[model samples]
Target: MGDPVTDPAPDGIDEGRRLIRLGGDKGLSLADRLAERFHRLTWRTPLHTLRLKGRYPLKLIAVPEDPILGDIARGTMLLEGVLSFRGEARDIETLDLSKPHPKPFAEYLQSFAWLRDLSTVATRARGAPIAEYLMGLWLTAHADTQGGIAWRPDMWGRRILAWTAHAPLILSSSDQIYRSKVLNALAKGALHLDRTADKAPAGAPRIAAWCGVVAAGLLIPGGEPRQAFGEAGLLRALGTGLFDDGGSVSRSPAMLLDSIQLLTLLQESYAARSAELPETVAVTLTRMVAALLGVAHADRGLSSWQGGGPASETQVAAVIEASGVRTRPLRQARDWGYQRLAAGTAVLIVDAAPPPIARL
Candidate 1:
C-alpha cells in the first residue's frame, strides 16, 4: 500500500488474459440448463396463472419514500401523454404502443423504472387517472407470459418493485374491476420473479429480481415459503455480487448507489415486520458504506470510475444517510485496488489496478 508512484510492476497480466478467454467461451452449465427446463415447465402451468389471478398482498411492508422534485416534474409531463425515458422523450400518442419500441426506450418502458416518477403524479387528484390510463395501456399491450420485453426477468424485477412501492397510487382508481386486475398483475409479476430469480443473469439484474422476490414474500400474506426463498436468494446474490471489502463485483459507482438503496429498502421491509435484520445484510451494508465513502471525492461526490457516471454529492449523501451507518473513508484498499494520499493541504487518489474484467 505504498505510494502508487513507487509501486512495483503489477502482476497477473497473463492470468487475467487466460481468465478472460475461459469466461468468454463459457456457456450455460448443466445445472443452469436443468434449472431453465424446470422454469419453462413450471411457468407454463394453468394453476400458476390461476394463482396470479387471485388475491394480492393486502398490505405493503414498506412504501418508498416520497418523490423528489425531479420526480414531480417528470410525472407532470407524463400526465400530458409525453414519454421521457433514458434521456429521450416522445409523445405517447404518437408512438405505436402495440409493437416493439425503439432501443433503450423499449428497455426503459419494459422495465417500468419510470413508474416511480409516475407515482408522484398519482399522488395528486388530477394526475391519478393519467397514471391509471397509462398502466392500463401497458398491461393490455404487453402482459403476455411467453414472449415480451415486459416479461423479461430484469424488467419484471423493476416492475415488481415499482408496483409494490406505489400500490396506493395504482389502486386509487374507482373501478373495482381495474383494481382487481392491477392486483392480479402484481401477483403474477411476483410469481414470475420467484420462479426466475436464480436464472437471472448475474449482477444488478439478479440482485433486483431477488429483492423483488423478498419484497413479495414479506408483503404477501400466507407466503412464508416465498418470503424465505426470497430472503435466501437475496442473501446469496449479495454474497456473490459484493466483494468482502464491500466494492461491487462490477466496480461501478452507480451500482454502489443502487445497492445501497436496495439494502435500505430491505432494511425498511424488515423493520415493518419488527423482525431482526439478518447478520449478513447488516454486515454487508456496513462494508458497502465504507467502500462508498472511500470513493468519494473532496467535493463529496463519487469520482467517475468503472464506466460509472458522476454521481452528485447529494445523491451519495442521501444513500449513506439511508444506510444508517456511520463510517469513515477507507484510507487504503488492498483487494479493491485504490489508494489515498494526503500531504499537508494536498490530497490525491489513485486507481491501483486495471478495470474489472467485466468492465472490459
Candidate 2:
C-alpha cells in the first residue's frame, strides 16, 4: 500500500483525520464542535437516565437477519477473547470501556458488528456465552452514558442494528434479568439514535447513523415515528451523498461498497417485518448497485480510486448477492463519472469524473 501522503495525495477523509488529531480541523469551529457535543445533554442527566432505566419492552417484536456474512475464522478468534480489525487486535477477554484504543479498533468494538459474525459460528463453540459476557460488560460500563467513541452516531447506529439483527445470539440466556437489561439497552440506543442521527459526521457516517434509526424503528414495537424520521434523513442524505448516477460523493469504490452493504441490511430488515420498502430506499439501492457494476472490471472486482484499494472479488460478490439488485453493469455512468468500454478482447475503464474530493 502506498502511503496516501507520499505515494499519492491523501484522501480528504484522511486529511480530516489528520486535522482532527491536531485540533486544526476546518470542518467544525470550536463552537460547532462543542454544540454538536452537547445537542441533547439532557439525555445524559442522571434523572433522565433513571427514567430510561425504569422501563423497556421485554422483547423485540421480531428479529431480522443481516444479509452480510461474517468471517468464520475471525469469529473463532473472537471467541478466544481477541478481536482484530485493520491489523490491530485487542485481548478483550476483559476490556475496560474507559481505556483508549486506536481509532479504527475502537470503532470496530463499539459497533458490535462482530455480533453478526459471531452469530454465524457461535453455536458451534462458546460463542453465545462469550457474546453475552462482553455485551454485559459494555452495558454495565456505558448505560445511558453519552460522549466518546461509544456514543458516536455511526457506531451507535451500527450497534443498534447489530443488537437488533442478531437478538437471538446476543440476548440468548436463561437469565431473565440479563435478558431484560439487553432489551432496555436496545431501547436506549434507539432513543439516542432518534435524537442524534444527524449529528454524525457527514457522508458514510451520517448514512450509517440513519441506518440504525430505521432498523430500530422497524424491529421495535411502536417505532413508526423513528422509522419515518430516519427515512426522511436518509432521503436528504441521498441528494448530497450520491450523484444521479449513484456513485458515492466521496468517489471511492470502498465507500460505495460500504453503502450497498449497510443499506441492504436495512432493506432486509424491512423485508423481515413484511413491510413495504420505502420507494426512495428502493430506488437508491438499484442505482447504487448498477453504478457498482459499472466500475467493476469484467472479472467482477472494482478499480481503486480516491485512495480506495481495488476491493476483493469475494467481498464485491457478497455485497451484490446480498443487495439482490439485478441491474446490469453500468456502461457509462454520468456524474458518477465512470465509463466502461470494450473492443475485441480488450477492456478499458476510464475515470471520467472529477478528482475525488476529501470531504464530500
Candidate 3:
C-alpha cells in the first residue's frame, strides 16, 4: 500500500511520499533500536525491578467480560496450538520469545491475548486446562525476566486486558500454587504497565498499553489510584494519537481497527464494574466509528488506504459489532484523513492527508 493519494487517478502520490520522507511510518530506524537497547538495559536494573515490586492486585474485584467475539473454529485452532492475532498466524510450537518474530505475532504470544479467542469455545471446561497450561508456560519462561519482551509495556498492557477480561479461563485451575502464579503475574504486569505505559510508542501501541493499565485499575482490588492514573494517560493518548475526527494518527485502517478493538476490551471492564463510561471514551468511539466507516466498502470490508490492506468483512464487522457504537461512515475526515464518495453502487475513497509523523 503506497501512500493513499487518489483512487487510481492520474494524480501521483508524491504528497504522501513526501510526508513519508519527512519521518518514519515506513519502518523503525537504527536510532530507534539503539535507544531501545539502552532504555531496556537501564530499565532492567536492580533498582528498577525493586520499584516494580509494588502492590500486585492479588485478587480481582470482578471478572471482566470479553467484548470482542472470537470464532469457534479459531478458538478450536488455538486449542490445537495454532495461534492467530490480527491476521497473523503462526504455530505455538514454533514460538520463541528470546528470538525475533513478527511484531504482531510476538504481541499475540507474549500478551496471551489469544485467551480472548479461546474463550469462544463452546466448552469452557475443555479449554480451561489448556489456557492454564499456557499461563504456566508464560510464567515459567518470563515470570522472573522483567527485561524480556513479555514485559514490554504494551505487551504487559495487552496481557492485563486478556487475563482480566477472560479471567475465568486462565484462573480455572484449582491448584493453589498455580493460582498464586497467575495472580502474581497479573500483578507484575499491571505494575509494569503503570511504570512504562507513558513510554509506549504513540498510536495503537500506546492505546493498548494504557488500556491494560485501566483494566488492571478497574479489576484489581484497591486499584482506584491506578485507575485514575491510567485514565489520565489514556485520555492523553487519545488526545494526541487520534485526530479530533476520530481517525488514527497513523492513518492506517489497521491501526483504527486495533484502537477500536483495544477500547472495546476496556469497555468490557467498564461494563463489568457497572461504571459509567468515560465521556472522552464515549466520544472517541463515536468519532472513530464514523471515521472507520469512511474506509469501509459497501460490503462492510475496510478499503486499503495509506499503507494498509483491505481487511476481511468478517473481521471489520466483528470489531464494529464489538464496539457497540452505531455510527454512519464519515463522508469527510478532519485529521482523520480520508474522503469518501458514493453514488448508487459506486464508491471512491481518497487519502487526503499525509502519513503519520514518526513521533506519532
Candidate 4:
C-alpha cells in the first residue's frame, strides 16, 4: 500500500467552521450564558482568593524529578528550604508559589520535575528526604489552587509522569503517613489529568496529557478503566498528530523527535505491565521510525526545516537508537514532499513543495 492522500487544505478548517456556526443563533442561549458567567465568577473568586493566600494541599504525593543540569542539590545545602538555580536561590516557603515565578527560576523549577538527577550526586542520601520536603512544600503552597501555571493541564501531566517515574525516590521515606498522602495526591493528579485532558491545547500538550494518564493507569493498581480511557485518548492523539508518511502533522523535525519519544514511553508503559502492545501503537512506531530515517541526512542529522534548528548528528543517532526499530533510511519521501539528492558520499535534501497553506 502507498501513503495516504495528503490533505491540501489547511488544518482546523472544519473546526473553525463549526465554531463559526456555533457563534450564530445556534449557540448557547442568553440565560445559559448568564449561568455560565455566574458559575465562572463563583469559581474564579475563590481560586483568586486561594492564590493570594497561597493555601495549598498539605500532603505530598510523589517527588518531582530534578533536572540533569542544575546545582540545586548543592544550593539547597546553603539554606534549609532554598532552591537555587542559575546563581539565584530563593526560599521555597517565602516565594509566592501561587503566582508565576520569575524567568530563569521558573525554568529551573520545571527542570526540578526530574528529581532523579539529585540522587546521582553527593546528595544521594539527602535526595529522597529533600524531594519529599520540597514536594510537601509545593503541595501545601500551590496544589490547592486551580488557575496558576502549576495547575495547568500540561504541568499536571508532566508532574504525573515525573512522579510516577521517580516514585521510588520520592516514596522512600519511612513516614507511612507521608507515603499515603503522596499516593492519594497521585490519585488526585491522575483524576485531574483525566478530567482536563480534553481541554489541553492540541498537539504535544494533549499527547503528553494522554500519555501521562496512560502511565498512571498502567502503574496504579486497580486502574483498568483509567488505563482504557488513556489508551483511547492516546490513540486519538496519535492519529491526528502523525501523518500516513510517519511525519508529524506540524511538519517539524523537532516535533518528529518528540513524537518518537512519546511513542517509546507508551510502548514501555505497556511492556511494564506485560501487556501486548496495541496494534495501532506498534504500526505507528514502525512508520514513524521509517519517517525519521527517511528525513535523516547522510551525517545522521536532520535538515533545518519548519522553524526547527539543525539537530546534532549525535542527537539524531541517539533518537534512532532509542526507537528500537532497525530500518534503513527511506531514499525518497513523496508523500512528505521531500527529495534526497546524493553524489558519491555527498548528499543534499530539499523541500520539494511549498508548506501547506493552512499551516501558514
**Highest TM-score among the candidates is held by which one?**
3
True-structure RMSD, every candidate = 6.5, 8.5, 6.5, 8.7
Give lDDT tens digits, candidate 4, residues 1-360.
844432222222233332111112333457866764564354346654433341224343223222223234654443365666656767756765555667657744642443534554435466677777777766776555455556555566666666765666677888877777767666666776776665555556677778878877777776689789998988887776666656665567777776676566556666666775578777777777776666678787887787766776776776566556666454455444555667777877766544532421
**Per-prediction backbone clash count:** 0, 1, 0, 8
Cα-based TM-score, every candidate: 0.79, 0.84, 0.86, 0.68
Model 2 regions lying over 4 Å from their true place: 1-55, 343-346, 356-358
Off by over 4 Å in 4: 1-97, 101-108, 111-113, 116-126, 342-344, 356-360
- Those runs of model 3 whose alpha carbons end farther than 4 Å from true positions after fitting are 1-38, 84-99
Residue 28, candidate 2: alpha-carbon lDDT: 58
- 1-360: candidate 1 lDDT, tens digit per residue: 632221221222233332122133245677877877777566567755665564665445555542322356667778878878667787876655577767678876766666667765555576567667777877787664544557666677767766766666667788888887776677778877876777776657778788778777776667779888888998888876666667676677677777777777667666666765588878778777776777778767887887777888877886777667777666565545556666664567777654665421
Candidate 4 TM-score, true structure as reference: 0.68
What is the lDDT ranking, best to worst? 3, 2, 1, 4
Whole-model alpha-carbon lDDT for candidate 2: 0.75
Query: In order, what lDDT does every prediction score?
Result: 0.68, 0.75, 0.78, 0.61
Clashing pairs in 4: 10-358, 60-182, 61-182, 65-113, 65-114, 65-115, 66-114, 66-115
Q: How do the residues 261-292 of candidate 3 rate in per-residue lDDT, one tens digit apiece?
A: 88988998998899956987887887888888
